[model samples]
Target: MPPKPSKPMMCNRKALPVAAKLKLIRKLEKGTSVAKLCEEYGVAQYCVNATASKSGKGLPRKHMKTARETGLDAAVLKWYVQERSVGINVHGVEIMSAANRLVHM
Candidate 1:
């Protein structure tokens, strides 16, 4: 028997830009059917429907959080740069030690 075709994979977070997502959102808000959108955009119905439902919650695919998102990590990075600029003998151990201290406090 011939093999059945597999469904396309769900979009990865990076697959669609914010602008594209917003456009889809706008179309959904304007009463376009999710099935129509799914067919047009080649995306799953859930992607269009979820964005349609979360009009106020937040952007659906915010970039993943990173160290900068945590205030402590940003502060530590700034401190590391400043110390190096002053010719202080900063080492990896010292940086990690400081980070551990700040995290514990």
Candidate 2:
């Protein structure tokens, strides 16, 4: 018997960016239909509804941490910029080494 070909899978999951969410909210305010918006954005109707309901709230910064961590982040960023400006190819291991050196200083 010959092998059968498998059917293609269709996945509809999507994560909309903040700007796109804001655009969807605006369109909703302008009386655009949810079905139409869903079709246009390739998102589910529930996503559009959720975006409309959560329009004005600010998105939290996932990378942000305490003051000490922020200071470390700034120091590492400065080191990275300096290294790059001097024609150095900064790799991940080198970055980690610089961060560790900065931490102990």
Candidate 3:
């Protein structure tokens, strides 16, 4: 098994930038899975969503016109679509809003 994450690793705030977070959320809106993002960056679900919420925008991978969109990679996008088509539903707005609320607490 992998080593347990240290406190710092568990609490990193530099996973992504404000603009990048916005891009990530928007990418998610186009059927991306939050779990993929969490695993990809070793970030908690709340972190991914809260960052996006603070940016006031969701990053839609489909809307991406270049290869520089951080964290919303092609493999992750494919997994996102596959997971979405398999009946797994992740309510984006509600999830993000709740994450935001929890972050502010």
Candidate 4:
């Protein structure tokens, strides 16, 4: 019988350098979105925020608005509610029925 293979090792690395963290903070301050920052930095927002948070730092304040507050079209919302519903076989009919009701409302 072949010898058993050892389990792979797991390692968690430390966060980025202070300078890099500051640079990201500056970019965030300039109105960059957290999602965009995460994509550009090749790191998760949680990681970035965790590092920043450790330094008692915060992302820039921006006037944020939700879709509904920004005048989302009723028809568009209705369509979205319809199209974005769960598609499980068990819930297919229920989802469609709910969507239809919203569309008509």
Best by lDDT: 2
Task: List TM-scores for all candidates, in order.
Answer: 0.39, 0.42, 0.36, 0.38
lDDT of 4 by residue, 54-84 (tens): 6667654445765543333565555556566
Model 2 scores a C-alpha lDDT of 0.80
Q: How well is each residue in 4-98 modelled by candidate 1, as lDDT tens digits?
A: 99976756542556788889888877788778878778777666766666675334655676674388888789889999999998989999998
lDDT of 1 at 31: 82
> How would you encode candidate 2's per-residue C-alpha lDDT over 32-72 as one tens digit per residue?
89999988888877777767756643243245556667788
Deviation (Å) of 92 in candidate 4: 59
Q: Among these predicted structures, which one has the highest TM-score? A: 2
* Model 3 lDDT tens row, 7-99: 555665556766666667776777678898777666888787776665555454245467563444544555557768998775767455644
Task: List candidate 1 segments past 4 Å from native.
Answer: 1-14, 57-105
Pairs with steric clashes in candidate 2: none
Per-residue error for 64 in candidate 3, Å, reads 35
